[model samples]
Target: MNFIDLFAGASGMSEGFINAGFVPVSHIEMDKYACDSIRTRAVYHYLKENDKEDYYNDYLKGNISREELYEHAPKQILDSVLNIEINDKSIKSIFEKIDKRLGDKEIDLIIGGPPCQAYSILGRHQENIENDPRNKLYIQYGRFLKKYQPRAFVFENVPGLLSAQKGQHFKNLKTYFRKMGYEVYHDKLNSADYGVLQARKRIIIVGWRKDNDHGFPAIEKIKRKFTVNDCFQDLPKLKPGEALKVTPYSLNKNEYLEKYELRNGVDFVTQHIARPHNERDLNIYKTAIKKWNRERVRIKYPDLPSHLKTHKNESSFIDRFKVVDGKGVSHTVVAHIAKDGHHYIHPDIKQCRSISVREAARLQSFPDNFFFEGPRTAAFKQIGNAVPPLMASAIANKMREYLCQI
Candidate 1:
């Protein structure tokens, strides 16, 4: 099956679909750094298929530049990543480019959702958010469905999308998709239910042609037997301001890492680096970690000593400083982590810092071999915004099964 990914942030959704044996027609994304990431991922897939993974490993080890890696990959593979924004002015050209890529093939699926910020609960608090331009990106998504008329589509977004504008936006979305000749079914799904270590809930809408008999795919829940510690146990520990781009594993393989392919037989790890923290924040982290370790209680920002308190808006967002629970699934990883790590502090007090890039990726179910392009902040933004590949692969497998029958 062939599919086109829209708003393909870091190609997480694309990775899952590819892992399920679906071929990507093209990936459309606006951010330059994200586009580069998608291209790099495409190179990885292409090299792996041709038994040239050594080239990719070299890139990870900093032995070769990204340009050199791209030089080895075919032009079509690199060109499959479209670094253009989707809007009225660009949709036509976008369609032309995708059509060229498609050639004689048809798109079996259309996957991806618009930026979720406009519909997110936090975003709704902003003034005039209803008029936010991002809210209208769905119209562009509808346009693609209308043009391609694929057999099915998967729309993924934050759960806040269900209640956006008092459910009016969702109603309009269903109506719009219906007009495009799709029968839509939706449910709120937790990533943990699909094998991701983080308990992130998202709104997943599956739509098929109105003429088809298929309904939403029944994705079964997975019982988790491991905690976030399983994801963290093998990586080398780091203090604040420390970094290790490519380092050998600190420990042997464990059940969670082996079962989920997070380790993926990679001999080395990259981006296991931590952000620098001030003495004040480190002290606060110590308090938070001590509280959680001893009493299993999260230390709220308001509970901090007067010297530790920084933000004045104490009435809300009081639990701003948080520790990643090593005993269980983590809280939702958000793009805000790029701006600061207060909400994603590491559980180990010895580190006295926020989680590293590789650690964050592990929480999101990204494999060890998957190298994120661009700087640390950009990588975090991509990871936080991505659809966890483990969950996406499950969803994609279900979609493929349903498509095959019809």
Candidate 2:
């Protein structure tokens, strides 16, 4: 069956559905960089169109100064202006194209994780208010459901979505979707239970169309936890800065970066290049590593934090990136790992070195053959933010069982 992935960032959700044997018919994304990483069945062309138009207008129109354009331009005139110019299409036309593709054939599901950070409980706490403009994007998702009338839909977001302000917003969301003729279930699910080897808990909202008699599946208990040893026990090991000859299992560097030139011969950068740290910084990193080792020993022998009790090998305090066992399942991968290597350390050594791109991918449960095609940070972000393909596949199987009851 076919499915449309909306707000598809790097196709993490799409990867899950594909693993579950569903075909992705289209994807809607605005970020050019992220779009480059995952091939889209379809994309919202309007964003690129407007951006191109805006660039050309800004550069070619010598008649209008930038300051004058910014200050004196009428609101109506600005509204008419395309940010990226392409006259070939609009959003409505794109949706129509999708509808044409869906004609006669049945699509089993529609899935996405719209940028829901604005409404996230963490965002609310940090921002000190609930005025995130992104919060309203769910309305757009709702509008899509009303229009397409898919058999089922899944909305994924941070766990904070369920606990934010005692879930008033979540209540409203359920009521609205229920009003739209769907029986919806929203709960936080731990990725580790589904072989992610991470402690991440995301809020997943699964729903069936009102016309359908499908009942939601009960959450099943997984007898075993996916561990670092389960995932990477078989891949060939590579040391820091050691580039492997173009292998079937490697990923290419991102095409959007200007700093590193990708020659035709070399497909990927082996690891993140490092710079020399000052003496004091080096000392601090050493101390952090020592402290981390001590913590690990203590946890293994005695009282341990709940988060670390079951994940002793994955708990590298210096930077969690290190694979404690070089040939084992990886620890929980987080988005912030891209910004700093503080959470990841080399699995083989105790130095404060960051994990290689390949190592990071393994940690996120990406198959060795699955490549990321953006800048380093973008690649890491994609890995960090994605739903582990294995975990997603398990969830999809459950969804199928849930739909069978209809």
Which candidate should be chosen as best, given TM-score against the real structure?
A: 1
The runs of at least 3 residues in candidate 2 whose Cα sits more than 4 Å from the true structure, single-residue gaps closed, are: 40-93, 119-122, 229-285, 297-332, 404-406
* C-alpha TM-score for every candidate: 0.99, 0.69
The parts of candidate 1 lying over 4 Å away from their true place are: none
Candidate 2 residue-wise lDDT at 45: 19
Worst 10 residues of 1 by lDDT: 209-218
Worst 10 residues of 2 by lDDT: 256-265
User: How much lDDT does candidate 1 score?
Assistant: 0.92
Report how far off residue 349 is in candidate 2 (Å): 2.4
Instruction: Give the C-alpha lDDT of model 2.
Output: 0.56
TM-score of 2: 0.69
